[model samples]
Target chain A: MEAFVTLDAVAVPLPLPNIDTDQIIPARYLSRPREVNHADFLFHDARRVPATDEQNPEFPLNREAWREAKIIVAGKNFACGSSREAAVWALFDAGFRCAIAPSFGDIFRNNGTKNGLLPVVLPAEVVEDILAQLEASPGAHIHVDLPKQEVTAPDGSTHGFEIDPFAKHCMLNGLDDFGVTAAYEDDIAAFERRYGRENRI
Target chain B: MSEPSGPRTLFEKIWSRHRVTEREDGQTLLYVGRHLLHDGGATAFDVLRQRGLKPRAPDRIFATPDHYVSTAGRKLAEIEDPRHREMVEKLARNTAEHGIRMFGLGDPNQGIVHVMGPETGLSQPGLLIVCGDSHTSTHGAVGALAFGIGSTEVAHVLATQTLWQRKPKTMRITVDGTLGPQVTGKDVILAIIARIGAAGATGHVIEYAGSAIRGLSMEGRLTLCNMSIEAGGRAGMVAPDETTYAYLHGRPYAPQGAEWDQAVMHWRELPSDAGAVFDTEVSLDGSAIQPMVTWGNSPEDALPIDAAVPDPESAADAERRAQMRRMLDYMGLVPGTPLTDIAIDRVFIGSCTNSRIEDLRAAAAVADGRKVAEGVLAWVVPGSEPVKRQAEAEGLHEVFRRAGFEWREPGCSMCLGTNGDIARPGQRVASTSNRNFMGRQGPGARTHLLSPAMAAAAAVTGRFADVRRLVGG
Candidate 1:
């Protein structure tokens, strides 16, 4: 995991709600090994024309100005279905370090945190303001400062966000749950020694 | 620290038991009681290897090959797709290397991870269960606190047998009154999703209670809990009762003899006490729920079978109306078309949501002597090899085959378009599987989520038909 403190990058606006994992990275791409570049399959069904194999012109990702955006501003309940972490990996693989939405699927949100992909929850109105700003100026950049727990808009106005303090701590230190659990190995070994005698697998 | 007391919800009791330590920041480290792994386990195993770690408590982990295994009756070596074959092979290799027990493909104990857990008694009241699939809430039917986690979390559990967590608020969903004869558990859940939008239960662990819920069989309870994730719930639970105990009394992994008596004594005390207050409360009338089916590309876009497709103009908000229009366009459905009259190209009667033996029996009764409509591609995939054998022993397979439906092996076939089983492009399918998102069954495939009986009825009629009417009940 990479430590995430602050990111200043162009924000892409995808205003649709309930963009589920199936749409993020289809199940068809799930069989491949972890090393496969999953970014290519991100929104495979929605982004490409099935008949012509060309990028769908209507999709915001296909717009030239938003092509390189590193932060995604989406509608409510983004990444809503399935527990596939491929969704987060695909976003990270595609160079998106942050996604701001009104809400997110529980597992998707957790997966993002574990992978250092910051999923920032904001009020719907605040998200709308961000999207509005992005629409007004296609390549506008937003700054997210994890240490400060604030998001600064292109106009220099700042909005506060809430994240679990432990999650924030882990993100700042590039730590994972495994690393945190390793700290208690002595206690775990003690419990296992006492409990293992009774229940043998 | 002192205990705050009034009455605790079931979720609170179970969460407290599993809590190992808590930080001032409101995050707790929870000791996982059991971990369920499926073929997706391979990916997490790859991560473990990358980190140069071994499973800390391999005894606590159980693995199975469900998602990527071919359910077309082919031997493991004969799997057509090399990628799918490699996934199953990797799972076998990893589980073996870790010395973890696996109910591999063709193992009688093997089935959909959710179905196999409770059937084998690996799930129990008061335990905290985690799996890599969203439908893991199915195990909560046994009164356990279970929810889906991502692969990274799976690897974390492999390394520590614990999860870092913030406790979720509790919601109580009370369904009262008796269901009509034709209605099943699937209808109950669909009705709940219809009443509450997909995200209505977000950030909450829902504890289902009330008369109707208590009246359901263990399988029905599982069905209700299985789809809780679809409604954005972190987990779904039903308090342990006689029904829960009877189901776990003698299963392979259940406590036995004196231990069993002691376990029941503890489980009997697991239900929420009177006057317990939930963060949110929702109640539904069971009798009013009909044989339900989804009309658009969301589980929440559901209606009674007799109802017509919704008109976007009737939506309360412009954004919802636009969403309705887009979903309708993708589903190729017209507003006001009677749900029963809409045609279907396929009928799938399997998935964690509706693949138990009871589900198979219900579908078999519908397809008993009826011939499937020409051009309809129908399949009945059992939940597990044991379920498959039980259905065969009861001749349920014969009924489905006689009705022109293909009787297949146990796996998640045609559920999410894996392992070469998928509805063709532009095809509309009536599926017992949970989700109906666009391309969920296959690219350009339209899915109308329904119960097994409704799916079987569609197989015979070539369109969505009221199961009650088909059976003349």
Candidate 2:
């Protein structure tokens, strides 16, 4: 995992709510191995014309000015269905370092933390403001600073956010689950010695 | 701070027992009592290889092939798609190499990972279970604190057998009174999702209680918990009782003799304490819930079978109205169309949600003497090999077969459009599976989520018909 301290990049606005994991990376793409790059499949169904196989110009992601956006501004309950981690992997592979929404699906948010892709939860009004700003100026930059737990808008106004401190620690240090668990190896071994006796296996 | 008052809820008791250590940030490391894996386990294995890490306790992990395996009665070697075949083969090889117990294609225990867990007694009362599949909450029927985790968490559990977590707040959803004759667990859950919007249980673990929940069979209980994730719950639980004990006794993985007695003694005390308080509470009248079905794109877009499609103009808010309009557009449904009048192209009676023996039996009862309508195609794919064998023994397979329903092998067929078993594009289906998201069944496929009996009714009638009306109850 790469450490994420701060990111300053263009923000893309997608205001639709309840954007589920199926839409993020459909189940069809999931059959392929994890090594396969899934960015192309992100919103594959929504982005393409069913009859012509042409890219839908109306979709936000297809807009030329927003093509290089690295932060996604979305509506409430983003990534709401299925516990697919590939959703996060696809967004990361597509160069998105952060996603701002009013809320996120429980498992998808957890998956984001593990993969070093930040899911920023803001007030609905704040998210709407950001979306409006991004819509007004597609290449406007948003600054996310993990240590400060703040997001700075293009106008230089800053907004504070809350994140799980441990998650923040892990992200700052580039510590994946293995690295975090390795810190308590001795305790884990002790637990095995004590509980392994009665286990079914 | 003063000592807390009132009795602890079942969630509290289980959570405390599993807590290994608490970090300063309010996150605790909880030991996983059991870990279940499926074809997706390959990703975790790949991560392990990349990190050069060995599983801390291979014995604690169990693997199976479900998601990508073909459910067309073909042998594993005959799987046509090399990618799907590779997924199952990779899981088999990885489980074998890592010394993890695997229930492969031909194994009697092999089935949907969630079904295999409890049916095999690998899920026990008061245990913390985690699986790669979202429907893992199904094991919570046994009073376990079980929830789904991502592939990265799978790798973490493989390495440490523990997950770092922040404890979720608790909600108690109490369904009162007895269910009407035609209503099933699927109806109860759908009703709850309808009552509370999709994100109602967000950030909370739900404990289902009260008379109606208690009256359900183990299969019914599993069905209830299986859809808890649809309501955005982190986990869903029911306290262990005589029913749970009876279901587990003598199963291959359950405790034996004296140990079983001791385990039972502990489980008997696992119910929520009399005065336990929940962070949130919601209640429903079981008798009022009819055989329910989803009309729009979300699981929460549900109504009783007799209800008409809701008009977008009647929505409480603009956002909701817009959402309804989009859902209606994607489903190809008119606002006033009666749910029972909508025709379906296919009927899928399978998936982790409703592929158990009881589910199959319910569908079989509906299909016993009735012929499937001419234009409709129906399939009954059992949850596991054991479920398939049991259904065959009971002549349920013959009943379905004679009724023009396909009796297929055990896997997640037609649930999420994998393994070459998908509804054709532009087709509409009556599905017992969870989720009705666009393209969930197949690209451009419209799904009307319903119970197994209701799905069977649609199969026989060529349209959505209320199960109560079809069964003449």
A1-201 per-residue lDDT for model 1 (tens digits)? 888999999899987778889989889888776688878988888898867878898788878888888899998889998999999988988889999999999999999999899999999888888888898999899999999999999888899999988889889999988877888777667656654553433
List iRMS for all predictions: 1.6, 1.4
Compose the digit string of candidate 1's lDDT tens values, residues B192-221: 988887888989999999899999999899
Error of 2 at B68 (Å): 1.0
Local error of candidate 2 at residue B392 (angstroms)? 0.9
lDDT of 1 at B32: 82
lDDT for B342 (candidate 2): 93
Task: Tally clashing residue pairs in candidate 2.
Answer: 0
lDDT of each: 0.89, 0.89
Residue-level lDDT for B200 in candidate 2: 82
The sequence of per-residue lDDT tens digits that candidate 2 reaches over residues B23-117 is: 77788888888999999668888888998988878777887888888887648876788888888899989888989999998998999998899
